[model samples]
Every structure is written in structure tokens, then in C-alpha cells.
Target: MEPQWVPSAADIAGARVTDFATFVTARTGESFPDYQSLWQWSVDNVAGFWGALWDYFELGERSGAVLVSTEMPGTKWFPAQQLNYVEQVVRQARTDRPAILGVDEDGSVIELSWAELLGGTAAFARALRELGVGRGDRVAGYLPNIPHAVIAFLATASIGAVWSACGQDYSAQAALDRLGQLEPKVLVTADGYRFGGKTHDKTADIAALRAGLPSLAVTVLVSRIGGTLPDVLAWDELLAAPGGQIDIAPVDFEHPLWVLYSSGTTGKPKGIVHGHGGVLLEHLKAVALQSDIGRDDTFFWYTSPSWMMWNFQVAGLLTGATIVTYDGSPSTPTPDALWAIAARTGATVVGTSPGYVLACAKAGVVPRRDHDLSALRMVGITGSSLPPSSSLWLRDNVGEHIPVASISGGTDVVSAFIGGVRTVPVWPGELSAPYLGVALDAWDEKGHPVRGAVGELVITKPMPSMPVRFWDDEDGSRYHDAYFDMYPGVWRHGDWITVNDHGSITVHGRSDSTLNRHGIRMGSADIYQVVEALPEVAEALVLGIELPEGRYWMPLFVVPAAGVELTDEVKARINTAIRAEVSPRHVPDEIITAPGIPHTRTGKKLEVPLKKLFQGAELSRVVAPTAVDDPALLTWYAQHTPPN
Candidate 1:
């Protein structure tokens, strides 16, 4: 495929990656003519590349080895480095620019300066200390994507306490399933949050959530939308405490900075722990170099606290970029709400999901035409694969010059393996390149690398951002079995990918939810790309189920477009398109009209869980109700199971 957009000479010269290349050449006496060569050298000389980054970023002196071990799940990075995540962020603080921009659905905006941010963080840190929260203690937040959430997280990090959060959208039971694992000593929550022009009172839910977490010593509540809870400390009061000099507690390189949870589609969500030093280094590389964001840039990603993108967006602060937090629905009052937020905030780099882009496309919403998005340098998409049609739509509607960076990684690493490179050409529906130091490749079942064909996405080398450990997994058995069990020592990320000859990657979908038919394995994303592209289809879910006697049942569930009926003609067109675009053998056994498709809170399709539901598994056993976007959809899917 031809490149949709290529970097101009000026763009290349101005990018941070180019400067880093020059720095690398000066240090190693090696010249990298292009990104591919640079990436190869980075993976080959992991220690040298990481050490160079430490020096390049001026992340203080490194006393010990850059990399102590190379073993998967055991790799030790910056073994002797004692640093604080908040310290790195504070180093970038400037008085002239705001540190954060908080926006709401009502178009209200709040600007937090670096001095005020540090002061608030200091106050909250002192309060946390008073509450007996110390190093390694988990501080959980049941809050929305607001400035206070950022303040609370920074405060937790400043005190060397591990922070974990769930969006206020989750039910109390759902919050308990994830946050209860931490047994946090301090819980920061909001009485309510605004979304879709409505106030959702979470005070009752917060009370229930607090009741379940027996380890909680104190609950601090932010009174959003005029809701109130009894016996909880007010957010204002917490920040009103006597502010002193910000105290950034130095911790070990592997000290847990925060705990992120996996989508508990199968069982209890696993608390994925990441360290302070690793996150600091990786984010500086990701936000500054690959995405080309810097001091003057205002970065905004439409994400809730539950998603890793929120964590990634917080990393923008590490680069001295002002970050924007939106605490409202993406489509509330208008389909272009997020675009408007980006424009109003003057966000240079805006990130959203593919679903939102496609929804905008279907709604005929041209962001550039409707909103003043001239400040946008890049539009990032993640959470799932970006269909080719959606990518093209963004190029035509958003801006031809602004690259649509379709990044694919997961909460597992809290960072991307392959994503945007400012100096690279933007290919429709493909990530620009494997991120520097990420030894990413597509390998067959036999462990041989393959190109132009779908294979398992594996990381052959250690990344600084890979999880330091899993909470409560003392023996390391669970962590080992999660990634390394598939390919011993190699991180087997459970996604199908195709690395084309041009070095771009296309993530198909989850390998565990693959659609296999007649000895051919296909990704569910392939079907959605073709089926959902049709004007009549709003969303699609394809399932490939193994039946008795080697027989297979493949069903395609679709949510029809608004005011459109799923007649025989629509089904026929879908079948013909699948037959031509995909394969005849992979066509669904039947086309079923559904009310809606279920997704996780972070906007991932519930493919594996729904497949388990159709395969006669009990609803309670297959998936937790609160984990889904609409729990009723699970019962509806269970009722519509295919016949034997």
C-alpha cells in the first residue's frame, strides 16, 4: 500500500527521534541512516541504547549496570538507580506553562500551573503520610478522569505509595474485584461524576466499595456534581492542608510505582505492577521521541482512569508537555465532543480509540471542518485495530498532514510495542514502526520469524516498561504463565500480527479469540474490518466455535445501523463481501441481528467472554456483570446461542 502521509524534511529535522539518533551516533560512533537501522541497533545493544537514553534525557547518574539480567519476567533494568516518578515530572515543571488542563462535558475548563500542581501534590502527600500510608502501600482511587485524579496519583507517587484507580463508571462490585486485591490503605473517590450531560451519583457505590475494602484506613471524596457522602474527607480539605516543600521519596528502581489491572473477562483481574524508574525512562522515550511531543505541546487522550492510556497520558508530564483530562462522554451532546476538547485545549497530540473514529465517520462528522483542530499534529488510535477504511476516513476528514498513529499494545506493559514514529510515513491501518528498544516480531508456532503473514506477536528482548511483578503473586507462577508460558523466555503477547515487508505492522486481533475455519486461522478483526465497513452495519462480532465431531460453527453477530433493518439483502451483501474480501470458508454460518455488542469498560470487544457464553458456560462463570459495558447484553447473547 502506498503511504498516505510521509514526513517532510522539516518534520524529520525537528523530530526528537532525529536528535536522539544524532546523540546515539556521537556516543557509539555508529551512524543510523534510518529508523529501521536504529531500531535494530537498539534491540541488539539493549544496555547501550538504554544507557544512552539515560544520559540523553539527563535522568541523573546511574551507579550500577544499565541491565543486570536479560531473562524474561526477570530482567533487571537500572538495578542501582534510586529515583522517583514524581521527581522526574517535577523536573519538567515550568512557571510559564500549565501542567494540566481539566475539561468537562459542560465546556468548563480548569488550568493547573506547575507550582499549584506541586503544591497540591505536596499537600496530598502530607495527608497520605498522616494517614499512615507509606512506601509499598497501595492507595486506590475510585474517581473519574479529572485534575484531582492526577493530583492524587502524583501525591501517591511522591510518598512512594503504590497507586491504583478505577473509573467511577464501574459498579461497586466491579471496583472491589480489582481494587480489593490491593487492600489499599487510602482510598480517594468522587461523590459523583458528570457524563452525557447528566450527573451520576456514585456516593452510594462508593459507600459499598468502601465497605468491601476492609483494609481502607481513610476515604477522601471529591464532591463532584453536588453529591455527598458521610464521614469522608472532602477533596478541598485534603488539598487545603499546610503545603510544604514537595518531598519526593526515592525508591529502588524496581519499587512499584502503581498497580494496573487486567480486564477480568475470565476471572479476577490481575494487579499488574510497574516500577518507577522503568516507567519514567520508557515514557520519556515514548512521549518525546516516538510521538514527537515536547514542552510546548498539550497532550490529550480521551481516557478514563481505568484504562492504561490515562497512565500513558500522565507520562506526557514526564516530557514537560501539558496534559488534558476530560471527564465526560466522547459522544455527549455531540459526536465530535473529543475533537472539540482537543481544539479548545489546543492539544497538539490527541489520542482516541478506533471505535470513536468510525462512529464519527458513520455520523458524517468531519472534525477539521467542524472544529478548529489546526493545532493537532497527530491523532492517535488504540484499544483495538484501526480498520483500513477508518484510517482513510481519518486522513480525509481530520487532516491529511496530521498522522493517524494506530498504536497497539496493552495494559500488560502500560506502553506500546509498535506505534507512531514522527519521521516515518503513515500507512493506512498500520502502525508506523516497532518502538525503539522493543524487540517486536511476528513468529509462527514453530518460533520462526515471518513477514507478510499473520503470526504471534512476540517480544524477543526486555522493555523497561514491562511489569515489574504482579501483586499478590508472590511465587511468580502467575506472572510467568501469563506471558512466558506460550513461548519459553519470549514474551508471547496474545495478539495476531502481520509484519509487512516495509517494516510496518498490522495487529489482526487477539489470538485466543481467533476464527479458525477449514484448517485456516483468521483474526476476528479481519471480519470486522470488512463487515463493519458496510453502511448498514454499525458493529460486528464474529465467533468461530468448535463443535462435536470436528464440526465448526461460525456466527456473525451484527448491530444494524440506525433505522436500518437486517433484511435478507443486507445479510447477503455481508456474506458476499466476506466471501470476496476474506475467504469463502471463513464466512459465517449465519448472520444474526443483535441489539448491541458488549465491550469492556476500556472499549474492547468481549469476544472471548461472549464466545464462552455461547458455548454453554454459565453466565456467572464466563464473565462478571460489572466488567461489561452492558451486562444485559451478556444475557441477551446467552439466549441467542447457536443450535447444536
Candidate 2:
């Protein structure tokens, strides 16, 4: 498809990325004619580009030489530098500005100013100190997306203690699988949380988590609805404690700052560690330069702390943007609840997921008609690939001129590899461009770069935001095997992707989730795009099941929309659409009616996990039942037989 939205001259000139070009010209006495050229310069001249970003963001006092070795994993990056992630974020806080804003599922609101945030962190840091928590100690949060959670994270980072959090919605076992890996010294949590207008007390679940982690020394509780824990510090008490001030002590550049978990669809979640300096620099570029967020911008992203978007959402503060977080049912009192929050907050850049957009589309919820989204210019969507119709739905229903930027990255990097570029036109259902400083390309199984064809998404170069290390993989063998084992030295991010000549990208799905029909490779997303486009289909999951004697079957399981049965006509329509829209070879061998498609809590279809289940493997070995939204549905996959 030809690009539908192009930046006007004013739009191009006013962009931060354009300012970056001017900044480069002034600093290096070189002129970049366009955004892509500047991006190329950023890739080709990593030292100059990253070093300039460090100076531009004023990250910290530069002591060590930048880019000591240009190697992949062993890059001697700022070996002598010292910084703290919290100090870099909090230093930008203006006492007059609101630093954090939150809304509950019950429509309750919470706001914290920069001064209050500073004071709250100081007090919480004192409490952590009292608990004997110090630099390099682990701190964890099992809380909702509330102001207190943000304050607690800031406090943990303030004390140089590593911070990791799982939102209260996670199942107890899933919580154990992730937080158990860290063995945090201090665990901050809420008594309960509200979702879909109902309160779920987390007391028992919290006890289960406590029982699993033997290293936990202190438990702090924030009563959201209202509850008390014996012998536990209240969140208010921690904030109102008598103690005093906190000056963030600078840690080494490579010191482990925080741990983020990889989606453990296959096995135990790998604790991917990132350092203070690397995250600071990467976030500044991503938030300020990539998304065009600034002091005047209100950045809102709907995410649980379990997802990396929560980390990115809070990092918006590093760019002086007020970070607005929502923790509750996106559609409760009304289907337009999230848009109402965006309107109330005057959000400039609204971050969301594709599933949410599709839900709104299916429900006929129109933001432009029901809400005052005058301040909204950008709607950023991630989590999964967006179909072309849904991309157009934003234009037709939300705002004709608004750019709905599709972003793709994961917990692996904790930052986007492919996303929108304000300087370029955004093609519908396509990413605007590759993220600057990321050498992203599509590659075939033979390790050759391929464009305009779906192939393995590979990172040709190392990124600063790449994990500092996996938590327990001491010899780095697991890390190497996870990314580099397939293609030696290069980072094969296990997603199927295609890059067009215009630099726009279409991410199909996970490479592991790709369906192999005979010898042809197909993305499950391709089947979904064709099947879900039919009015009778609500959602779909497709996987090629390999059987004994090299037998194979591709089954398409779909959740039919209300009043729409999986009749013969619908089946024929699906087959015809697949054969027409995709290809004759891309049609599934079987069509089955599924009551509901199973997904991870984060809105990803459980294709790969289900494939393993149908292949006669034990359910537990395939995926953590707690990680899935519907464990019962997963078991049903193994029980149901496809048509002969």
C-alpha cells in the first residue's frame, strides 16, 4: 500500500528528530539531508551519535571514553562512567509540574507532583534503609498501576536497589515464577485491586508469593480497597516516616540497575538485566527523539507492571513528560473509558495495544464521537501486529489526520526496534521506520538479508539496551543460545518480519509461531488477518501440527462473533479469503469452531504453546498454565481432534 499520511513542512520542521539533524550539523559540522540519512549516520558512526546523545541529554558527567570496543557483547561502553537511573529521571522533575497521574478501574484518581514525588521517594528510601536494603539489593513490587507503585519504583531506584514488579493481576504461580528469580530483599504490594468493577483481595496470593521467596525480609502493603497485614509496613507509614533526604549515589555504568523478565512461554522467565547509563540514554532517545514526547506532552500508556511498557511508560519522565498510567478495566462503565482518561489528562501521545483497538472496533466505540481527544496527535499501538482495516479504523473513527504509529519490540531489549518516524509518512498496517541506533533487518534461514519478504527479524549490531546479563546464567551460555545460537554473533529476535524498500516494516508474528505448510512458511498473523477480517469471525489462532511419519496438519481455530455460527458458508468464505488474500498454498487444512481463543494475559495468541500441546507433550512442559488467560481452554486443545 502507498503511504496514506505524509508529514507537512511544519510537521517535519517542528519534529525533535529534525532538531536532532540540526543538532548533528552544529556539533559535527555535518549536514544530514533527511531522517534516514541521519539514522544511517547514527548506525555508521555509533560513537559520534551515542556520545552526542549522552551530551545532548546531559546524562551524567562524562569520565570514561565512549565506545572502547565495537564488539557485539563485549563492548567496553563507558567503563569509567557513573550514574543512577532514578537521579537522571527525577532531576528533570519540576516542582510545579505533575509527575505522576493514575486512574483506577473504579474511576478513582491519584495525582503526585514533582515535590511530593521527591519527598515520597526520600521517605521510602529511608524505610528501605531501615530494612537494611542498600546498593545492589533486590526490591520487588506486586502492586497495581497506581501512584504508590510508581513512587515505590522510584524509591527502589533511589537507593540503588534493583527494581522489578508484577502487577497485582498476575496469577500467584506466575508471580512466583518471575519474582522468585530475583529473591528480593523488600517486597512492596497492595492489599487488593479492582478490575471490571470487582475487587480481588490479594492477601492469600501475597502469602503464597511470600512463602515461595525465602529471601524476602520485609513486606510493605498499600491498601487499595482496604486491608491490613500483620507485621507489615503500610505504604502511608513508609511515606510519612520521620527520616529525611536522599541524594542518588552514582553507580558504575555497567552495574546492574534493574531486571526485566522475558516472556516465559517456553520455560522459566529469563531475568534480563539492564544498567543505569544504558537505559537512561536509550530511553531519552526513544521517548524524546523517537516518540516526539516532551515537557509539554502528557504520555499515557495502558499497561501492567508485568509488561515492559510499564517501564517505558515511567521512562517518559526522563523526557520531562507527565507519565499517565491506568490500572483497571479499559472498558467498564463505558467502552470509551480509556479515551475519557486521555481527554481528561490532555494526553498528547496515547499508547495502547492492538487488541484494545480491535475491541473498540468490534464494539463500535468511537473516540472522536464520544470523547474530546483534541490534544491527542499520536496513538501508539504495540503488543502485536495490526491488520490494515484496524489501522484504517483509527483514521475513520478517531481522527482522519492522526498518525496511528505501530511499534514492535519486546522485554528482550526493553525498547523498540521498529516503530514510527514523525519525519516520514506512516503506511497503514506498517511500521514507519527502524529505530535509530538499531541495525534491524529481515533475514532468511540461510542467514542472508532479505527485504520485502517475511523472514527472521535479526539485529545486525548490539544495542546498549540489550540485557546487561541474564540473572543466573553465569557462563552466559543461555544468553548466547537464546539469541545467537541460530545465527552466530547476530541477535535473531525470534519474530518474522518484512522490510519494504520505503523502510516500512510489516511484522508477521513470532518466527517460532510460523506455520510450515509442506515446505512453504506462513505467519499465523497472515491467517489471522484473513480469517478475522471476515465479519463472522471474532478472533483466530492457527498452527501447523506435526505428527508421526512426517504428517502435518494446519488447523484454524476461530471464535465466532455473536449470532454468527461457524456454518459451511462461513468456512468456505474463510478458505476463499485465505486462498485469495494470502495465497492458495496459505489455506489451512482444517477449520474448527473454538468457544474462545486462548491468549497470554498480555493479549498474545498462544499459538506456539498450543502447537506443543497438540503434539502430545504434557501441558506443563508446554507453558505455565498460570501464564495463560485460559488454562482450561489450553487443555481442551489437546482433547479436541481435527477433521480427517
Candidate 3:
């Protein structure tokens, strides 16, 4: 830790604090409180907690009932309410103030004022209506981080249509895997994008995708890279369409707003359906409390259109802050591109995934030391755990006064569990506490709350932001099985973590059979499927094990096919195939050929025990899944493991 980076209180005095204890405290309010009390209040009274959040933000018109219960797992927030998500976001855009800032790879910047954004979005909404894109229709986008992407989403969401998006970098297969499930009516995308000194286009890919999805009516293209446009209508032509005034359509609070997918645990991805009012209200509250977004503030988050961070970042505008969108790799022209953009844009709050920060640290780029970050008041880190080294580096180099808030949560809830506060004390590498209104608890294997030990991270109650349903999941069986089935109605998030004595949390990666490799989240099954498919492999087991660098990396061990010999070429081929089939992150650093893979009594792979074995750590009796075969395989794996 840098000597100059003395631990200190959170940067929360000037911003809002929705709730603390029995009294609801506003930014201008006199008294202040700590994290523990606030967290207790949120967990104790879930309905009132969410209600306070809704009221604090002066949310959508309350046409229906408030809430029915705050009971764990089955809690229904705002039982009856009707509001439009896009209306809440766009409604606050006053004429002159900047609403959106877009910076491309070429260092060219485009700024859109609130008036411009609102008008353009309205026109887009009108064009959609002309195209017969109405309520319940699905409008999908495979685009980059640009103003038009935001506008398209806002417009689609405003009209009560479901908006889904994927980044341009996504492969044709990945795009089809996600978008095909939603079956969007219109496909909105750009011809190409520039990233990592490469010009990549989706023209051919989109053409192929369009052919597969019969429900797609129109193909909308926003030209960025210089190329011949396909049969898709140009963006300018649609924007040039007669600007007709369309009244913002409001809908039920629970009406479907957006549909997104998780990287599949099974073969096909799970399409998570999020609602209108709940997402808007919850996101607004999050931006206000977690990020401390203000009217005068300009917010920036480096995220691809595919990542859920895009949804989290775009929602920052609901707090009336200018959103800065960048459409290229952070290191495209230089390692300092993001900082330079933040400095130039006068961004107050800079948000990025932990991987980006670690990369910046590895590049020897000191942000505050190299760039004029005086305007940067807070730094929000997510997507992965903030390495203690990087956390200290940020605190020291960036300015000790600048709070480094490490937030955690996923698309399932469309909100955060642990995040920042305006006035609470900031701790190093600690997610201060659960966000207000979210009933989060760190429970041991026995399903009892425990402290200072890793356990299953579960949210006792359902929040407003919980996904409405999974697309095409008839009878709600998939939806129920995903969350409630684990604990019989409790929302069990598959995160292995521990809550510290100070109420802060440390995430231990996914509890489910998945690996968080270099911040690229992928299911273990993805690796196993490829590994087992090989002719040289009979069975394969993969696990994400912690490395000395304080991060998790994938390690693979496999049983050789019958009598197949272990050779360097076999290992090379397996690595090569994994990189091609999955993302680059799927390739394990070490691939060892073993005689057999360990399995439990029920024939399921003992991933946890094998993971522990690989790490040279011990655990109590493993949770034997009903699928293991060879118990002796574990002993063999431990002995033949590669030397460190």
C-alpha cells in the first residue's frame, strides 16, 4: 500500500443517502449513519426499504398498490404499479444540458444535449411505430457503445417493446445463441466497429443471423465503418423520417422492458426478462446511492454493448448525469485512452470492470499521476473482484480522498448487493454492505447466517429489480428452477463469498460449476464439453482455482481415451480448440492428462473437491452430487499434479 493512501471515510457528504435507521435521510438532511444500521434496516423491512427508495427518487406515478410482503424469497415488491422505464429516463432530459457523450476509437468525440437526445429518441420511437413496432414487440440490437445504441434502446423501451443488445465483437454463433431466443422483430446494428487496431464488421454475420430468425421484419444499420450497406436501411434515412410527435406510452410496472441472456450453463443461453417500472426505479436508486450520480456530474463506464455493465451504465442517466460512451478498446491508440477521455470529458465518476483497472495497472499507467483527474471524484469497479494490490494502487496514486467503490451483483436482479455510499467510511477491497432494499446474507452450508467465513451468498427476499421471467419458459418452470429451486423459494445467487466483521464482503467466485477467468465468466461445462468431445479424451474435469497472483485461473485435468498416449500435440490441440470454440479465456493455463476423473456417488463430477485438491487446500466433507463414479481418481490427480 502506498504511504500517501491513508484509509479514510467515504465520499458521500454532498450526495444522496436514501435511508438509514428509522429516519429517511436526504443529501441535505442533517444527521448521518453507518453501514451496519442501514443494512439492518434494509433486511428487516424490505417493502418499506424499497418504498423509501421509490419515494426518494420521486419515481413513476403510483397507480397501483404498494407491496404485499417482505418475506424472504417470495417477497413481491410494489405488488401493483404502472409506469414506463424509458419515460423515467428520457423525461428528465431538459433542453440544454449534455445528456450523452460518445467517444470512438479514432479519438473523435460527439456530444448530445438532453434536448437532442430526447428529440432523436422520440423520432426513433416514431419510426418504430411506423414499422409497427408496438407494445410487446421485440427490438434487438447488435451494436457498439454509441449514442444511437442508447437512443434505440430508449425508444424501444419507451414504446413498451422489449430491447435486447449484443456487442459487435460477439461472434456470429454467440449472437445467434442470444438473439435467436428472444426472436426480435427488428435487428438494429452497425456495419462495423474499430477495436484493438482492427476493423470488424457484422454485415455478413447480421445477414446470416437475419436469415435464421424469421421473425425479424426490418434490418436497421447505423453506419460506422466505411463499407457497402446491405439490404438494411441506413440510420440517417430513418432519423430523417418525418419527425412525428409520439406521446410516451406508459405501462404496467411489471410489463416486460428488456430481455438479456447469460452465457449458457446448458447449451442454449437463458433469456432473462426484466420489467419496465421495477428496472427503471431500481436503476435510478442504484445510480443515486451506489454511484452518487448528480445533475452536474458526467459519468463514464467502459463496457461493451453485450455486457450487463452497459445496462448498469446507461441507467446512470436516470439520475440526470451525462453518460460518456466509448466505442473502442481502452488500449486501441494508447493505454491512456480512457483516462484521456475522462479528463477531456470532465467526467466526475469513472466506472470500469476490475480487469480494465488491473490491465491499466499492469501497463504501468498511473491514472491520476499521468492524467488530470482532479474532476474525478469517485471510481466504481465491478465485473470482478478488485485485487487488493490494484485497490491500494488506485487509492494511493489516484488520490486517497477518491473513494474506490467495488460493487457486485449480476443481471439476474439488475441491481447490486454490495456497493458504495455517499457518507459511510470506505474500506480497502471491501464491498461496504448490501445495497439498501436488497436482503442479502452470507450463509454457511447449513443455511445459517455466518461471518468471517466463505459461504453461499443468498438474497433472502425478492427485490423489485428481479427479472420478470425467462423468455419462452413455459409454465415458469425454468424461472423457478434457476433461483427458487435451490433453497425452495429463496433467491440463491451462485456466488461463494464471505462477509467480514465490518459487514463488508469478499467474493470467492461462483458456487455453481463455472470459472471466472481473467474476468471472462464462463460455465465449467463449456470447457468440459469441448474437452470431452475430443477423441483423445475419455472424461474431463475443469475447475477455477485461485492463483498466487490473487486471482482465479482455469485448470483442466482429463482421463485419456482408452489407450491413447499423452503427448504435447494432444495438449496443444485441446488448447487450440478451446480458444476457437469458446473465448480466449476458456483455454486453461495447465492441461494435464490424468487416468480418471473424480465423481460422486450419484455420478456427477466432484468439481469442488477437485478444485480444492488442485489448489492444495482441504475442506470438510464435500457436497456429493448424485453423479460421481471413481473416488480413487482424486488421489491420483493430487499425486500427478504439475509442480509449481
Candidate 4:
């Protein structure tokens, strides 16, 4: 299974950005011989880097100071420029070209041209303004991946309002827990979402959430699941409402553009606030440079509004590329549904997480044999560290020559640390390089940057797109503790990572996800050492579960050898073998056979999502399978819970 097209040596040779001359001269009246000087300058002068970016994009400005704080923990960028983030994106392209393309689960496809998207967004913006939305007002959505989601995001950002969204698959309480923190003025949602031949209605939950939040002024519902919304306003009605041609409101560059949540480790999620100009400028660089998006490209990333990928996808608008949006599971109708869409729409870039690729492989989707993926030139992957085995499998089985980029970055930056580069060679299981203007370093605990060895991943300086503030943290105490407090001005991204000689990055899992059993700190990957190597196991999850007996006990959740039964002897062998390889604490107190491990919609083992489930909480709907499935495993675990 290989890609139909590969860049010839000539093509590769012509794609290099040898110097940062044009961008530098235009933004700063200076030019650099190479990217090294630019990168070093960014590290030495953080504020200058951000200020240059603002001018480079020619961002709209307001009548105040451009930036107020250059100090870490409260640093701000483009403080004086006032402009609506959405307005900048909307006007970036010609009105006749496509801006968004949505294909639903029922095989219905709809396209919105630049004019239509702008006009529709204007109408919705007018609707929000009329509904009393003003600067800094929070607008939230619990929706699926549809045109309306994009419409709502643009509309909210256009009006100088803060947009925050989560997936519709979230339980009523999970949605409430995150959205309530913002005290949003409006909520946009769909009636339901269809997945794996099932429909999950969100209307009732929306009503419940609205009732709980006194600040909610309106509820906008898109007709989904073939149901009518009597009380909620229809998406079309909001888009069609006559308003005297709503004008784009310009505001401060550092003004709040969006409010997103940190998937909480403790009680409630932390609301991270992103700025307008900084986010827009940085994303523009990412879309045009890293993604290699252009006016002729049709781009699609299988994502919901809940994840940061949605933010990344919408940035395609800034590049004048058509964003192909899909609202159902990739595996719906058939495992090849996404490929079919790419083939039909001629999507040049197909972005997804590594977990989805693995699932597709396990499901027997030989992409090269099953369908025509000639149009897809690149595949962007993130959400979890991609192992070398999976990366090679994709090249050998899915598509060769089509670079599989394993990107790593998150909500805080609104971009990637290391991602796809048009000129860089794609290596298996590694990120090609740190994004330009993002000074990245792999540092040991001693604060010295290191390479060819594992350490903490950190940015030695601030970037324009770092979150402006945290909601409810008036004094910025919590915000400080999250990033800066850990290392004084330097951002401590808590991932144990290694940098190769070629400057590629390899994620060794999360610093927090490391298991501590009997004073031994082991990454969850440590368990896979013996488990995956065995002939009888397809996959396994090894973690410490707190028992009612007041002790943390390790549990091995195993997907047994294919076509083999999970007998007591087989389970004993698994336990005995792991303890022998690593330590006894690494062995499981109970061997639970599961059909599949629960995972986030993005494909990361919802260690937290599953922790919620194990604690008797509702499960969020997952669009991709993250683990090997075994139906009887959870039941067996329940039967063996250490009695209180």
C-alpha cells in the first residue's frame, strides 16, 4: 500500500526555505541568512518575536499599548492590536472559493464557499450581538464535527466573544463541569450524534445544562438525529436573521479570543484563555508553512470541536484552503469511509491521530488495496506518541511516500512543537523539527539542554500563542503554577522526551502517567515491554488502581492472543512473566480480560476517561477505538473489586 504520488528529487530540492528573508524583512526590516539566526533571536527576545509576527500578518490594531506584560507567568503578546480573530480568517480568501465542506453520517455532503461562509458567519455574529453578546462574553458549544460547529466558532470570535467548545459525547455532568467554569452567555449544540450505528441525543442534556447555568442567555440548536427543536433556535434561523450587514469588530490583539479547558487531573478542569492576534498569527504560520496548505488544497482532519485539532483545522481558512469537515466516526458505513471522502473531495492532507491508524490496521483496512488515496499527499498524526512499529506499518500498509508526521503540542500553544515540514524528510516515530519561531529544547532535570538522551521538553522562551490567562484566576496564580511556576519563565511541558541528533523528537509518554508501584517509577510503556513481546497478547494496559483496601494495586488489563480463550493459567503466565521481567510491583493483582480499553475520542487511552468509567461515571463517545476490545474483561474486574 503505497501513495500514488511521491515528490521527485527536483520537487524536494525546490521546496526548501533556505533563508527567512522575505518574512523577516517584511516584519522587522531585517533579514537572516538562515532559520538558525531567526530561531536564536526568538529565544533571546520573546517580545520582539511576537511583535514581529503581529506586523508580519499585518494584524489589525487598537488604540492602546500593544503589549502590557513581558514577564513570564503573565506575559502577553500583541497587547495593543484590536481585531476579531474570525474576521481576519474570513477575509483571507476570495468569496467564490470553498471554505468548508461537511459530510454527514448519512452520506450527505455540503459545501460553503468563502462568500457563503462569511455571510453565514456574519448572520450568526449579528444574532449573537443581538442576543447581548459583547466583548469577553463566553459562547460555548457541546457539538459534533459539522458545519455549524465551524459557524459558531467563527461567529463567536467575530463578535469579540470567547468561544469554547467540547464534544457532544461528553456526559451531561462532564459538559457542565467544563462549560460552567466559563459562565457562557450562549451554548450551541446539536440534537444528537450518530456513531457505530447508534444515535446519542444531546438535546435533553443541553436543556439540563442550560438550567444549571444562570448566565446562559440563549441556546442555538442544529437539527440533528432527524429531530425537531421546539424551544431551541435553529442554526439556519440564526444564519438567516436579517441584520444590517454586521461589521467585524476590531479589538485588542491580546484580548480573549477563546476559552479552552485543561483535561483536569484533580477536581474541576482549568479554563485556559487564548488571545486573538497571537493565536491567529501563530496558526497562520503553522497552516501555511508546516502544513504546506495553499489555496488549491482541500484539507480535512477527522476531529470534533472538543479537541485542539479542530482549532488547527479551522486555521486552514486563513490559508484559503477548503476544510473538509466530517461529522461521523471514520469507521462508519465502512472502515474506509475517510479514504472515500478524501478520494471524492480530493483532500490533499488527511490529519488524524496515531490511534485511529492503528485501529484501521487492526480492522483490516488495507488502504492501498481498499481504496484510491491518490489525492492525499500527507497524513498528520498526534494526541499520542507514535511507536516506530506503527509508523512503519502505515508506510508499508497504508501509504508509502505520503509522509506520516507525528506532531506533539497542545491547547496551551494552539500549535505543534515539532510537526510536518514540506522540506524535511519524514522519519518513523519522530517529529521532524521544532516549529520555526518556537525555540524548543529537551532538557534534563539540571536545566541543561541535551540531545540523544531523554529529558523534559521545555521552551526556553515565550511564544506569541501561549494562553493569555486562565479563567477565574484573577491574580494569575493558578496560571503561573500550570506552566511558569515550575521553572521560572521557562515552560515545563511535563513529557519525558528525547531529541535525536537530527533534532527529531521522541515522546516517552507523560511525566505524570508514569506508574509508581512500591517506590518504582515506571512508564506505562514499561508494561508493554513484556506484554506486547508475548505471542499470546495483542495489547495490554498496566496501571495502578487504588483499591478500597487503602492500597494502590497494579492491574493488568489484557487482550489475549487472537482466537485464544483467557484461562486462569494464561493469566498467571502474564502476571508471572511481567513480574519477572520488570518487578513484582509491575505484576497485576488481577488479570482482567477486556474486549477493548476505553480511549479519548482522539485515541489516547482515556486513562482519565476510563478512570471516570471505572469510578462509575458515564463514558464519553469515542470516534476511534484506542485499545484492543474484549467484552468480558470489565465484568470480570467488577467481580474482583477488593471489597470495602
Leading candidate by TM-score: 3
Hey, what RMSD does candidate 1 come out at? Answer: 10.5
Give per-residue lDDT, candidate 2, residue 611.
76
Worst 10 residues of 2 by lDDT: 514-523
lDDT score, candidate 4, position 110: 93
lDDT (tens digit, per residue) of candidate 1 on 1-644: 89998999999888899999999999889998889999999999999999999999998887989988888879998887899989888899799899999998999999999998889999999999988999989999999999999999999999899999988766676678789998999899998888888878887888889999999888998888788778788889888866767888999988999999876533567889999988888888988998989998999998888878899999999989999999888888898888889889999999987667867887999898999998898998887677777788888998999998878887888888999898899888888899999999999999999999989999999998899999889999999998999799999988889998889998866666756443233456656767899999999888876543224578999999999999999999999987655445447999999999999999889888877666666889978989989988887888885676
**Predicted candidate 2 versus true structure: per-residue lDDT over 130-178, tens digit per residue:** 8999999999999888888787888888778899998776656667778
In terms of TM-score, how similar is model 3 to the real structure? Answer: 0.90
lDDT of 4 by residue, 1-644 (tens): 22223456664444423222366667677665544455566666666665655665566443454456656666656554557677667557586567888888778889887777777888898889889998889999989888888888888887788899977756565577779988898989888887666777766777777887889878888888776655677887777755344477877778888887775543367787888877887887788766777788899988767677888898998878899888777778887787777777888898876556766766877887766788777888877676666688778776787888678887778788777676666677777767877778888877898888988889876677888888889888888888766678888876768888765677755554445332223345545766778888887776554332124456677888789778998888887776545334457668778776644444455453343344343333312233424434344443444324
RMSD of each: 10.5, 10.6, 3.4, 11.4
Most lDDT-accurate candidate:
1
Q: Which lDDT tens digits does candidate 3 get at residues 157-267?
A: 888898998877665666777888877889998888888777776678777778878899899889888666557778888887554454678787788888877767545
Ranking by lDDT: 1, 2, 3, 4
Lowest summed lDDT window (length 10), candidate 1: 514-523
Q: How well does candidate 4 score on lDDT at residue 349?
A: 90
Residue 406 accuracy (lDDT) in model 3: 78
Which residue pairs of candidate 1 clash?
Answer: none
lDDT winner, 1 or 3? 1
Which candidate do you rate higher for TM-score, 1 or 3? Answer: 3
Screening candidate 3 with a backbone cut-off below 3 angstroms (N, C-alpha, C), the clashing residue pairs are 12-422, 599-628, 600-628, 602-626, 602-627, 603-627, 603-628, 604-627, 604-628
- C-alpha lDDT (0 to 100) for residue 369 of candidate 1: 93
